[model samples]
Target: MAKSFASQGDLTEKKITFDEVGPDLWAFTAEGDPNSGVIIGDDSVMVVEAQATPRLAEKVIERVRSVTDKPISHVVLTHYHAVRVLGASAYGADQIIMSDAARGMVAERGQEDWDSEFQRFPRLFEGYESIPGLTWPTTTFTDRMTVYLGKRRVDIMHLGRAHTAGDAVVHVPDGGVMFTGDIVEDHSACYCGDGYFGDWGTTLDAIAAYDVDAIAPGRGGALIGRDAVTRAIASTRDFVDSTYAPAARVAARGGSLKEAWDAVRAECDPKFRDYAIYEHCLPFNVARAYDEARGIAHPRIWTAARDLEMWDALQG
Candidate 1:
């Protein structure tokens, strides 16, 4: 029988944008792909999220070069997903930062996640060989850490458990811009393969309370203005709810994984069918939702073998 998988090449690289959010704060966004934020200080710079590989990161570096010559001295990884953290080496930052919880997640399942993600989406991992190794944090803090880029203050906070147990957001108070990693998405789908669905909603609420004027979400274009920010947050929440809630209910009703998958498809496909990565994310989302509804607190680590098994079980 033919393999029941879509080609990863279907996703193509698009142009990236650099938009000013505030004084010395900018959002580096691409069309519905992973985004990176730049916080420029008087002397140095801080990168919010790294792309999937060094080659990919250079694209952002080129953009950063066009506006400022400030050296990128730090990289803040919002979470421990392979696609997000693996490109840290390209930044050549003096310090790599993450939440304590995020560091622990890397120590626990980082390797497995690396293998699983590469297998799931080969297109994103274009220069797979360039990955130095699993990206590890040089500095980690619990709750929050305040860093000074000359006179500017950048607050890095864990906020709460959402996308992962250690999701961090970079809040630029002076700039009134927030770099929300996977916590907020504009038009892209949320990949809840390793998420806390219930806690994720509350986490978003906390982020909204920041009264941000602009937002650089994990994926999609940069959100401008208060209304755009609110709309992006709401859309992200709706995507999570519509994707996981029906599956959770079906699982509670004693339905099998396949059954729950069907229910989720029926409920969410109409709305999210055309969104980027929707097809790539559904199986993993359902697997996670099923586990959560069954009272599983921590998300299971996904290995390449398990990915295939889940896909086969649900898609067959």
Candidate 2:
């Protein structure tokens, strides 16, 4: 390859920020790295989105300790991505939750994703060896399930598929706060390698309907107010639209992947070049968009070898 995969070259560590997005909701964000959410209820705490590895999860645990002494009773995984779910064991929660579709994807392509992600972004999996094995949810729900953390009502729902086939969002009704997984991102490029462009916006629309006061997004900073939350949702939608349109256009005329790449860059570069992981996400996003445009409904599983092949073809 002419250059290292974009994330492979990203060695600089990001500054971590722990912000309170609601009455007892906290977001642990590290620049554009994967983000985790904390929901402190009346009795125990619930953590959303585990980091890539056990060691990385420890970082989130440290921050959670700073505020509340309640034990983490549950861990919620928003999706099946290795970067988001592999750190499950570290939490030691009594219950782990995911949408039913997420567990299906795990059975389908979990190991392939793990290998692909570990090669693509080494920095995020700082303690890869510490990860015991694939993380599995002890419990799962089909559409929506409500759990009461004491009197605090937490709703976990599969609004629709955006970033992945099984995308779950957590809503804390008391504080009007929502912990949207990758279905919503703030100032970060949506990694659409395994995404559904056709379904993403619809999912975003479902989230906007709630009009929640605050949001703990999948990445970047926490959206603390209605304005910030609205802006993030709009920006994320724009990014998805901008990425898909040009690639779909290229596909419509039976153009090469390289042509689709150029077209997407021309459209997205000026607007999203400064976004976190923009380069890392662009090639895969374009490839998937092209495939989707050509009528491929489901995304192809990405393996380590496939990652190198795609990078070499697109960036070499």
Candidate 3:
């Protein structure tokens, strides 16, 4: 199956859904927009994935207020994407958490990412100046760390690299619900601009082994039942495979970047034609896949200028 995109005419703002995925576990989804996961324990709250900006995060805070007054003590970052982490300060959490790798990615390329993303999607960055600065984590863990929101145990693990080198998943063992950052996304398009396509499959398999009952993907609607969860995983896997495989094959045949992009688009556009942000993501996705397929392990940093250059080179 191909990925879906947001309708160009679908200007309706997404409504937030605060659904109980399990006991003390909730998912705050905005139609097909970015999502935030909540782990409410006996005393406090842990939020997974802050929204894009402080102004945007306030909306999430409003929903969180509907449930508990327990202070949001922790904001966990699943990765170091500007759209995902730049809103950290809005949470007002005493401690911001992230994986060591994620923090490094932020320190290394956070500013460029901020400039690049803001330029790419201006609508998502409404109230852009309200952002204090690049969101930085106060506490970072190497592989795994356990936090107690009062009594509830939330295990934040960097299972493997998928979306980025710093991708992490918030696993609630007892609840059987996992808050997978960009490591997994429902019918939405996967933004693989800074991704490792070959390793992402293995990372996703590790996520599946957890036997999660429900999942809050980085983007898209929440997957409530086992069937829906399975579909989300499979759909994301298929997207990654369909996207990267053709690019890799074309590059292996000594094709130009434009040729590789065209081959992947021919294979993917027909299927994922309807996916949200398919048009927006395709150029960046193709660029990263092309680099990876050509044996460039680390994706080159993408600036605003670089973004346009790549888009122009590949899109036509």
TM-score of each: 0.97, 0.99, 0.95
CA lDDT of every candidate: 0.89, 0.94, 0.86
Q: Write the per-residue lDDT of candidate 3 for residues 1-316, one digit (tens) a residue.
A: 3222222234567777888888878888876677898888888889998888999888888888898898999999999988788888988899899999999998899999999887777767767789999888999999899998776789999999989998999999889999999888886789999999989999989999998999989888888989998998999999999999999998898988899888888999888878767777887888899899999999899898898777666645
How big is the positional error of residue 200 in model 2, measured in Å on the Cα after superposition? 0.8
lDDT of 2 by residue, 99-206 (tens): 999999999999999999998889999989999999999999999999999999999999998999999999999999999998888889999999999999999999
Candidates 2 and 3 compared: the better one by TM-score is: 2
List candidate 3 segments past 4 Å from native. Answer: 1-12
- Which runs of model 2 end up more than 4 angstroms from their true locations? none
Query: Highest TM-score among the candidates is held by which one?
Result: 2
TM-score, structure 3 vs. true: 0.95
lDDT of 1 at 183: 88
Taking every candidate in turn, the Cα RMSD to the unseen true structure, in Å, is 1.2, 0.8, 3.3
* Model 1 TM: 0.97
Pull out the clashing pairs in model 3.
3-275, 4-274, 4-275, 4-276, 5-274, 5-275, 5-276, 6-276
Candidate with better TM-score, 1 vs 2: 2
- Top of the candidates by lDDT: 2
Which clashing pairs does model 2 show? Answer: none
